[model samples]
Target chain A: MTAQPQIELTNIDKHYGSFHALRDINLTIENGQFVALVGPSGCGKSTLLRSLAGLESISGGTMKIAGDVMNGVPPRKRDVAMVFQSYALYPHMSVLDNLTYSLRLKRRPKSEAEAAANEVAATTGLQKLLRRLPRELSGGQRQRVAMGRAIIRHPKAFLFDEPLSNLDAALRVHMRKEIRALHDRLRATSVYVTHDQIEAMTMADHVVVMREGVIEQQGAPLELYDRPANMFVAGFIGSPAMNFVDGTVDGSGTGARLALPDEPSIQIGKRLEPGRKITVGLRPEFLQLASGDEAALHLSVTTVESTGSTTYISSLGEPEIVVVVNGRTDVAAGDKIGLAIAPENVHAFDPETGKAI
Target chain B: MNRVISSFRDGKGFDIALVGAALLFLGIFAGLPLVYNVVMSFQAVDMFSLGTFARPFVGFDNYIAVFSEPIFWPVMRNTVVFVVASIGGQFVIGFGLALFFTLKFPGSTYLRGLFLVSWVMPGLVVGAIWNWILAGDFGVLNFALTGLGIIEDNIFWRSDTAFSLWAVIIANIWLGTSFNMILLSVGLASIPRDLYEAAALDGANGWQRFWTITLPMMRATIGAVISLGLIFTLQQFDLFAAITSGGPANSSNVAQYWAWDFSFRQYDFAKGATISVLMIALVMVASVIYVRSTRHEVRG
Candidate 1:
């Protein structure tokens, strides 16, 4: 939201021997922004976070934290605090001692260190449990202690490496809001790494999606959801993933004829060369059950799964397309379903480069 | 019979049987000897009564006489110095080596494995080797020290009263350092690598991290190592026999060697038993410490 960038990464590259772990990464995170780097495992999301934390040396890059170039700076000198995925609390130390470790290491007076620990413990709800060692605490409590340890430092930026990956499902969901709320309250610049796209979509102000050593897309979550720049981004961003069906533009140039499972042609908003090959992207949530003449595609249902709140129906087509319907659906296996989608909802990409058309 | 058979199949009877075997072995080999030693310390026994259990009871005669011996205080002092110096030297050097190898350059693990050679060697063989190394003249240690200009003369490590105790201390440290390094290495390895990362990110400098993170995390391990060191150094006798023989007017003589001399050479059985009782008492405290330390692991 401001002109000044809190963290800037330009032409970042990393190599582990001959393997290029990161390539040509350029990103700017503004002050107080909650940014999430998200991708599947081995996609270098965690590696990028560690590079920002200075845990892993970058092979090549100009990484700036708070406007200072940070190439050869060690982690201790970087002034950034990291919450490890393991929570990595000192097992021998009590929660209070864990929080005060950095302060005490600086040879601060005992009273001053305890006071600082007390303040951070109060915020993290660890005040009552300060005397308990990390082993005595539950998983969630240990995680809070890990964060409290980092928070007391008042760091330049907070780097979180999959901090919620250890928690149970319900707790993970709860901590998502808590972490985002903590970021908002402190207005701290945070770079969160996760493999879960939902966490990125819901918690981050901006989300960067990465694939093997490269950023595929980055923007506001919905901006990415609505206007993904490539086939990979379109398929990766949404739940149930975007369905890609091979299609060719109609002679009229404003429509596409799907090439599978006896489905008819669908309307497109953009003009393209007639009869050009493309990959048509359709989101499951945007599809509707059609009756009279508005049907975009007719699919033979292969499987129907329901969780009382939402139902997912998949077609028994060569390129299987799934539709998510609200509430329970009577749709079952072997049912022929007629589905309709709007023109604007249809995304097309060049089949060769996977680039958006 | 049926219940026992069923219990065996279910693990309960088998567990009891396993424990009973160990207890029986301990009672025969360890418990009987320890109790016999304690009983003998309070009795008067000559060569004629040595084979019999019943001997003339002398109350505290043996303990008092043993304490009153002119060599008693000196031998006790030597034992204390031996244990303290050997343990301290082993631990410091081992810790340094462990931390050094943690940097993990190529072949460091293999090099650490090679250090175990000293530990596995018979103490007599190691002492024999050290005999050559600590020779009064034409010794490697003296050669190195004079070459470094730290000492101008050969210094006669085995003969000189000042350095005679240290001759054994030096060998014991070498014998024990590898074991210490191995255990400390395990402790260091068990500590999660992420804790250091977290500490580094918490603004701890290299020295600060070592002092706070490495030292505190190693508390249980250090306690175990030190207690084991006490037990090992107390048990150290072959090196004394093989090296100085606690010689040159009993200058390097310690309690274990004195116990041996009283029992085998002087044939004063009660005095030997009395000296051994004192050592067992010391080792009991160390055993308690070792058990407690190993049981209470400081890990999440």
Candidate 2:
């Protein structure tokens, strides 16, 4: 949104002995942006977040925070705050003391520290529970205390490492919005790390999908959803992952024929070499049940699952196809069905590179 | 009968039986001797009454006489100094070693395990070894001290009245430091590593993290370690016997060694029991503190 970047990382690399944990990572985040680094476990999302916090030093890179080069700066000198997945609240200290620890460490006056703690506590809805120790609070309350401790510091950037992973499902959903709201209210630069793509899609203004320490794709939430750069991003970004079916370009060069038993042909929006091998990507929600004349592919139904509002139909064949239909459908197992999709909703990828075409 | 059998087979009766065995053993071996020592402190006992429980009631006469003895105040002062100094040295050095080991350089686990050697060695054997190291003329400590320019002379550690009690305290501290380090290492290890990360990100340097995070989290452990140190130091008699033998003119004499001397050598069983009764009272207070501390762990 602005010309000045708040955080910039260029040519970042990390190594633990012979293992390269992170490769040439280049990213720049603008001021007050809520960015989420999301991937599966062992993908180095959390490691990247920790590197930004200065908890783990980069093996080779130039890291800048607030326009200052911070390559060798220690975490305490970095002027950033982190909320751990374990909450990591001071277990022995009361809620008020936990919130005021940073202030007290600076040798601030007791009255000034308490006033700051009280203000943060009120903002976090922890006013009535200030005297209770961390062990006395429930999981959600401890989470709030962890956040309050971070908020009291007025840090330059807030780094969150899977902060909602410990909560129950309902509470995780609730805290997701709460954390995003807190980020908006403070307008603080935040870098959130989580393995759940839904949390990334729902909460972050910009989402960076990662795999094995490499950024596969990064853009606005809908931009990534509508146009993924690769198969990994296409499968990772959507709820019901995109389905890939092997296909070959038709003689017309603008249509493709699927490899199913019927060899049904569908229109593609681009021109390619005739008889070129490609992979067709179809989203579940975009596929529709078609009548005989407009049917592109015909398949037998394998199973039908419903959750009151949507019906999930799995087709019976090799390279299984799943279709999500809104409202209830009477589709049952062993029933034959026809499927169709518009040309624009369909995506194609090169079978070798797995990159979107 | 069926109900009783069933309780033992599938209920609380078996648990009670297991606990009852431990209580019975304690009653016979430990509790009886403690109660007998308290009782003997209140009665007049001689060689004729040594075999029997019955003795003439003295009504605090033994306590008053023992308190009035010429060596009593000096022995009490020596005991206090011995306990305080030994515990202080052990804790400070042990805590330093514990924090050092947490750096986890290569082979740290093996090196830390090696520190347990001093803790497992018999006290008398350790004291015997210290006796050689603490010899008047050819001692390693005196050599190091003089080499460091801390002292000029050999100092005659065992014979000099000023350093006689300190001689035993030095050995006792060496004997106890390893145990202190081991317990403290466990306490330090149990702390989550993320807490330090959180604190560092919250703008606490290493020193502030220790004072705020490490020290408060170690409350239960510190309480337990200090109280146990008190108990062990109060019961420390082997170092005195092996190193100084209460020295020339009773200079290094303490309560436990003095109690042994009165009971076995002087045959003044009443005075011995009186001194022991005082020690038992102190140890009881320490026991209460140890239990309370270990029970109330400040963990989330």
Candidate 3:
């Protein structure tokens, strides 16, 4: 992030007649940065990406690319390449033709365009399928061709709109690395849009979590995982989700009393007003098997899923909590187990506002 | 009986039965007329011999007479012009309309549905309406043309030798434009919208996108439309029958009208069948191209 940023969006807003699609979006992407916009469906992430591409117009705001004001400019005038969710490979064109389409439109000589296409094909592993039509190629090959088509252009930015959502799990994992590797080799700025937080966590240098047309927070991947700004983000960023339980501050300011019968009250470092209510948040990965001489919550396990590499245990209680163990466990359904977590691993939130406090 | 019932429920037998029924229908309605026409072209027949199949075999005499007639080459030229002109006019205007309506303005689809009126109306009825529009002295077309200053006088669309053939061509184009527009619209709609978006992001402007994306994707549909247009134009007889009637010394007499004239007006059945058989050969070539183009569709 040296010098000036490559893309700058300021107070962007979009409306479809009476419906507001995007509300006051402000973001900045530095050159050579790979940013992922992660959110649930209908969260305006795709709309924001399309706005950057100029496929959609911003009703009110200033959009800048490489320090040039870009409002009212058509998509063609914007030097950006997008891999559509559908791949959108030209059905009537061979792979080489599809890759060299932009170059040809610029009236580049045949040899030059062919050399460019061939170079991209070599890296994308599309050399063998260069002469094939899109329909004749497999889904993964078409996906590569789509990537190749964008990569060959060397545009100011690369925008990917759920480019890998169509692949199976195994292929999806494989292509994820391929895309990240491609991004590293080519130091162009990229903006990726996806609903999968794991994809954002694994790939992006910076993750922007959006909800209802607003940016909830943006930071490095692990930063988002370790500390979420709000309760919605804490539940969204982690796999298997975080658990919540209601509790009241004990007479002692250092601990909170559980709403259950005959249990040890949870400990917190910060002191709160006695008898104040709070919502407790705990990540599944932080919970462990209870050890002797520690404050622990003993409960009956209702379900155990052993995936060989890790075991997932769900407790049976009024406020059900999940625990992820490192390896295979002997615990089965309806087994009594005690769960323990450190006070530092516990997160407290204002139950009324669902915000971290 | 059990095997028959089971086969009807789920087997190859049911498929064969459906195909057999279609073939039987085609054989009765289409095959019989084509065979009869071919046989009659080789036979010497009169009005009295029309009811019987025992006419004397003539062996190329009817074809020879048809070629040697003074009006034969003119009629052939007229047929070519009619087919070419009517199809060209219909296709260009229709494609323009199709693209225009694809913009999806308010009430556009309903307006397009209204344009289908020309396609659904009987061709003879269309010709009857065009007759009044093309009337010699006070026709609306001539009045509008003169008023626009494109023409200085009221040209006789149905009577004057120079304008009679064009009168039918104009009417025929109007009759066929809507069908072409509707079909081309479907072809335009079938293209995935994201292709254009991708092309736009690839640095292609509107015009370049049209040539690079829209036209190539519409190759199959355009081929089908043009071939179908040729067949429809060749089959166009009502406009000529209603408007010109090949009057003013065979000035507007195309092969189709001449074929009807030789058969019903002059009782020369052999020559009429000879002309129609030649038309069938042309339509067969068009049909082959239509089939090949559809089979080569590049689906996304």
Candidate 4:
């Protein structure tokens, strides 16, 4: 039989008075899996991570860690360490002491605790800074201390609550790779929470997207991007979010008619009831400029922005369509251009329910 | 002169004028009195020379007399006990209440505000209120003690020489606890909540969290509170005046109240000034600590 899941929650619920902070959250994390609970603010991603750490008590349902029911276990007893968004290093304690705090609490010998701290500090690249207090260190060093504190415990699972959100942009990218490398080296189960979809996509192996206290979807990072089960997940997963336009199935039953001026229609590549109203989603990167005979839609460019590596071109009228062209583009504003996309790249959702069709 | 006038028009003169006004006020009201008190402490002023500043330079004679008085050692001992016991009791009880209120129970804010009633009421009024509470036969304190079986009879808190100092200390603690609680609450609130969460996840129990997270993080605040508490407790004289009046042969006497008793009641202004000068030294140390801790807070 397969090993028991590292952490399991079934029908977990949380309520703050009348506000449902988390509802029907059922997640199972296996051993050594890095899971990310990602969403916009107020989406209960942090709440779910805190619940796993036992910082928040679930109002309903069972929680298990390593086959043991953790229904009422305190955070200390849960054997999970959390790195907070604020880093939360003990300001009065030196880096070594902060790393050794858990070991000391277990009444370990001073020599043993110091040895353990030294080893962890070496791994976290904090060897030279162990004697310094948190306030005496820079922000990135403090972040390393927070990570080292969690690492020393060799905890059953690691909980990271937006641990890199406080760092500068360059540092955030650097820490993202560093954390993933550290997780791989330790082979530890981790649940990270972040609002930045890019961080979640790059760092976590399994991404759980949430909205309004509900898990919208959870799958491998690419799976969520390739096939978001619904419109919210679709809109949330990609950068420069997916664009939607009102459409209806054309008379051919295999294409959708556009609502934009000039009535440009797209091939849906699947048969559907003719005249059925639907919403169509197109990703900006998938569209390309094409000749008139090969084009599915003709558009007037309203604005063109170049970020050196890629150029973004937007259409001029109702139902604005944007096209991202890799490298430089000769296209200018107010120019009429023909655009094309493969039928498989076009997505259709029911207008009423916003469900993938 | 033109430059000076231009500076005035540019508002620099107004800034200097404001600083000068504050300095002038302090020099006239606080600085001069302090210097005069120090000077009087070193002089041989008696009833005959009370109206003039040109008294004989006694060269520590007033300090010698004040220190060698029969009641001096007992009064000094009582002062130490009063300050220590009042601060200790206020700190422990106030810290407990502050922690309890941080639990954020419904109506906790209003209840904490209600505790400030004891602080806002004049200390004399508090002492008078405690006078009845500590009354020998009909006092509620006696009634509660007897009801709880901690004591079988009333102890005569105000008059009994054995418990008289303690009686005033109890009242003083009650008078000061709310201020301590308000300040400690602010300190507790300033500690980031995430630190506690981090400690908890690091496998620390609640007790460990208090020691490892709460206490260390509150170092500057605790320093500030205790120093302020020392200064305030030493300045406490109203409770003694209204309750014990340093009575029963000075059993409940302290430096501040006894200084007043010597100066105004017994007409020994030199001894009074000598005692106050000593208290000023103690308060100066406390002020140094307060300033340093606050500066550390800013740097942090």
- State each candidate's chain A TM-score: 0.98, 0.98, 0.96, 0.98
What CAPRI-style quality would you assign to candidate 2?
high
Ten residues in a row with the worst lDDT in model 3 chain A? A290-299
lDDT of candidate 1 over A1-357, digit per residue (tens): 567899999999999999999999999999999999998899999999999999999999799998899998999899899999999998888899999988877789999999999899889898899999888898888889988888898988999999999999999998898888888899889999999999999999999999999999999999999999999889889898999999999999999999886648999888999979999999999999887787777888889999899999998558888899999978789988888999999999999999999
For candidate 4, write residues A1-357 as lDDT tens digits.
248899998998999999999989989999999999999999999988888888888899899999999988988899999899899888778888999999999999999999999899899999999999888998899899999999999999999999998999999999999999998899899999999999999998999999999999999999999888888988899878888889999999999988887889899878899999999999888888997689988888999999999999998566778899999989999898998889989888888988889
Give lDDT: candidate 3, residue A3.
89
Mark the 10 consecutive residues where model 1 chain A has the least summed lDDT.
Answer: A291-300
Q: What is candidate 4's local distance difference test score?
A: 0.91
Candidate 3 colliding pairs: none
Better by lDDT, candidate 4 or 1: 1
**Residue by residue across B96-158, what tens digits does model 4's lDDT show?**
999999999999999999999998888889989999999998999999999999998789999
Query: Which parts of model 2 have CA positions greater than 4 angstroms off?
Result: none
Local distance difference test, each candidate: 0.92, 0.92, 0.91, 0.91
Q: Which parts of model 1 are misplaced by more than 4 Å?
A: none
Residue B131 error, candidate 4, Å: 1.8
Q: Please identify model 4 stretches exceeding 4 Å from their true place.
A: B5-15, B298-300
- C-alpha lDDT of residue A289 in model 3: 86
Clashing pairs in 2: none
Task: List all candidate RMSDs to the true structure.
Answer: 1.3, 1.2, 1.4, 1.8
**TM-score for chain A as predicted in candidate 3:** 0.96
Best by DockQ: 3
Residue runs of model 3 more than 4 Å from their true location after superposition? A259-264, A316-318
What digit string (tens of lDDT, one per residue) describes model 3 on residues A197-262? Answer: 999999999999999998988999999887788888888998989887888878887788666546
